[model samples]
Target chain A: MTIEHSILGVIASRPCTGYDIKTEFEHEGAGMVWGVSFGSVYPKLKSMEEQGLIQNYRTETKGRMKKMYELTPKGWEALHKWLGELPSYPSIKDELLLKLSMWDRGRPEDRQTLIYHMKNRKEQSQELLDYYLQWPQNGHSSISEFGMLGIQYVQERLETELRWIEKAILQLEGEPQPPVQDPYDLIPKQQERRNLAINPPVITVHPESSTDEDRV
Target chain B: MTIEHSILGVIASRPCTGYDIKTEFEHEGAGMVWGVSFGSVYPKLKSMEEQGLIQNYRTETKGRMKKMYELTPKGWEALHKWLGELPSYPSIKDELLLKLSMWDRGRPEDRQTLIYHMKNRKEQSQELLDYYLQWPQNGHSSISEFGMLGIQYVQERLETELRWIEKAILQLEGEPQPPVQDPYDLIPKQQERRNLAINPPVITVHPESSTDEDRV
Candidate 1:
């Protein structure tokens, strides 16, 4: 549905053929700002025409026959309604957090893995930040006013993400305790060996072992 | 695959029955921190057992025979590999951003919608922020040290999102101009009528009308 509305916006901006619509979404202001993909365009164009939201006509240019699409009155009304629709909560599925939740805190190697992923994610966000700074100035026209608003928001988000990564790294590096029962004891053979041993390092290494909350 | 690893993590935390695994995912620290769900757990458990990643034993607890699952040597090896795997870039598909990029800049109604959606998103992020600040204190135990790192990251993200909303609103309210070609002209009858008019409001309404970039 957003794809249709974006197409309508491009058409509303100018009467363009299907190929022209693809180019705009692939190369123009909306493409970079909205993350609109071109894969869904043709099928959506067909359905939108069938639904009477848009209409197209055949035109010949440069020895090619092109179907140029534009919004019908119905399309304009739909685009207007879509532009006003309330947005929903953005779904969050951060893999780093997901993996970190199950982490083996006693393992030094696991801590290193945690830092590796944080840096990887930060690098990717940094690349996006770099692109945002250097785009539009390259060749194509500047993004529209509303598009600028979206870009600016993304810019802040990536910056906050980078800053948060730094703070989290410092916290992890400074931390010194593993907070749960070591899963190694869940193995029966290991559990039996530990139980048979006289005073063990579980008591030796765990200075906070007397706390009730750490037991479960 | 992530589901499998998370289940492995839970089993590694403690040797637990299938039902226990479900409960932990539904009501424990891992659920909140990782967004793990129970829907796919049973099937993944079945496949994991077949693949030598886990083993289960029948236990009679309070007259109910339950299948308790535990990690194999192979399972521990898999969990280690997963925790070390370099994380990929998080997928971002923000609906508000996708819509904002296609906005009808000439319509006051459209501007209101943009502000409305921005505020709506901010309010939701604020609710998450309130939760981040208030949670764990309400419950069984404070999140593990690493879990604290993930929560702190989310806390900062939501705050940045809220602040970005304010800045975007200011930019939108302070500025004007419908950039690119207005889709209105694509309507043939409207285009013809607009062309026929001696002096039009496109000239009157568009103050940045003379800027070459504004012409699209």
Candidate 2:
């Protein structure tokens, strides 16, 4: 549903071929917000035209014929309707979070490797955020004001992730447990053995800060 | 790939029927990390069993037959292999971000509606964070320490989102444009109309904060 509306919205701004639409999404301004492959765009364009939401005309560029699409009245109406409706909740699939969830079940080396990877991730995020901060100087129009805001939003998200990674590394360092225990050893060899029998591990709970309640 | 490792990791901790595995995922500890519907789980389990990564046996309980799965040696090897490998980068498909990208093209009423929806989203995120904060009191074991960290990660993410939304609202409020012009009016009725002649609205660039550079 979002892809359909996003494509329509882009076309409503100006007439473009399917290839043009794909290129626009790959550009810095719209890339992160509405990235899609040629595989998805071609079929959607054909279907939207068949549904009379968009109309296409043949144009010659560089002595080659290309079909360019523009929003019909129906397409404009559909785009407006979508804008008025509330969007569905975003579902996240954070792979790093998935790995972190099971980190305690890994060996000490695995944990170290995870930390190393996280540091690399932190650097990558910083690079992306830096690139986004330069969007204003690139001469994007007032109509792209919202797009710039979206970039700022992503920048904040990356910042938060970097902080979390630092905190996690600290927590791992402060852990009182012995280093490099095999995960298989954490499980008892016999059915009667229990986790508590292995060690009297000290658990540190983060103290609740006053700031925790400030946002809520 | 994460799901396959997640399933193996769960089974390695303890043997369980597919029904039991489903229940575990719906439970508080594992639910957030590896949420999957029965439709995906069942097929994945069948294929994994055929590939010799997992094996199953029938057990009768309460006059009914239940098929339980356990990790084979190969499955254990596979899980460990995955743990040693670097995780894939998380790909986000944020619908709200998508809407925000095109927000400048929306009507005044549409922008107001978006603000309302963002507020609602903020509340929902707060509720989830609050629920996660209570995990320590619920007696999750030391092995779930990483899981607890993951909850904190999500909580911080939600808080960041809320802050961004507030900032976004302020930016929208400070917009100098007149209220409620038809979007079509922004476009030229004549074919030759170029975008720049539409008053070239001033875009207020956000000032760079010292904190932004501190992370990098």
lDDT of 1 by residue, A66-133 (tens): 88886776776676677777866554445677677656421334567688788888888898787766
Q: B89-109, model 2: which lDDT tens digit per residue?
A: 665666777777665554433
Each model's lDDT: 0.65, 0.67
* TM-score of candidate 1 relative to the true fold: 0.68
Output the worst ten-in-a-row residue range by lDDT, candidate 2 chain B. B190-199
Off by over 4 Å in 2: A29-31, A106-109, A141-145, A173-216, B23-34, B60-65, B140-143, B170-216
Error of 2 at B35 (Å): 3.9
Per-residue lDDT of B26-141 in model 1, one digit per residue for the tens?
54542233444456777878999999988899998899888988777677768767878876555554678767766642133457668888888887778778877766365443
Candidate 2: residue B211 Cα off by (Å): 59
The i-RMS of every model, in angstroms, reads: 6.8, 6.8
lDDT for model 2, on a 0 to 1 scale? 0.67
Candidate 1 DockQ score?
0.24
